[model samples]
Target: MNKLSSAIWFRQEQDTLILEIHVQPRASRNQIVGVENDRLKLRITDAPVQGKGNEGIIRFLAKEFRVPKSYLTILAGARSRNKRIAVRSPRVYPDWMTGSIQRALFKIS
Candidate 1:
């Protein structure tokens, strides 16, 4: 298993990192809610139409991970709420993410 295998929300893919997200589009604000079943629950203000929400997701991820927008890509589920995205060369991983990962590991062990 990979270093992040204990966590469900994301995993390292070679140099890049992959995020499994459950997006709540048209939300009042954009933010990361929590982790569930190995997926990160994200709330975004944009509606899920014409890829607007998808764009918002990329922007949010870029800022959160401290990477450029171009570094993030929608790997799958562009239209669906459940999305798999890849982020290249991230410079940050917030405490909430590491806490979640620890909780997941605690649950496993």
Candidate 2:
């Protein structure tokens, strides 16, 4: 486990959870890899162009977190692989993610 695994990567923004993410585009498949330097590492199937990777990230996260895509917002790093995304009005969060809004994604589903 890296540093972020011990702590959640999310920052509360009103009713949203802002997650710091580091993406690896054009990977073999799209999936949550692990934590690296406090950022959630994700492998993106889409190439980093025309926001395709960004879109993939949002869609994957929405499905993973069991939330609507509209509720997930890219707060920063839209054009870069490293990004900060926000999940709004979440109805469910994995038990492992109790305190850490950010690091939880790495350990759990």
Using TM-score as the measure, the top candidate is 1
| Each prediction's RMSD to truth | 4.7, 5.0
Candidate number with greatest lDDT: 1
Give lDDT tens digits, candidate 1, residues 1-109.
1223437677787889898988999999998777656688889999988989999999898988899999999999987999999999889876657765576668879
TM-score, prediction 1: 0.84
| 2-96: candidate 2 lDDT, tens digit per residue | 53354545666687877888999999998876677778788989988888888899888887778989999998888887898889977676444
Report the Cα lDDT for residue 23, model 1: 91
Model 1 segments more than 4 A misplaced: 1-6, 101-109
Which 10-residue span in candidate 2 carries the lowest summed lDDT?
A: 94-103
Off by over 4 Å in 2: 1-4, 94-109
lDDT for model 2, please. 0.78
What is the TM-score of candidate 2? 0.79
Question: What overall lDDT goes with each candidate model?
Answer: 0.83, 0.78
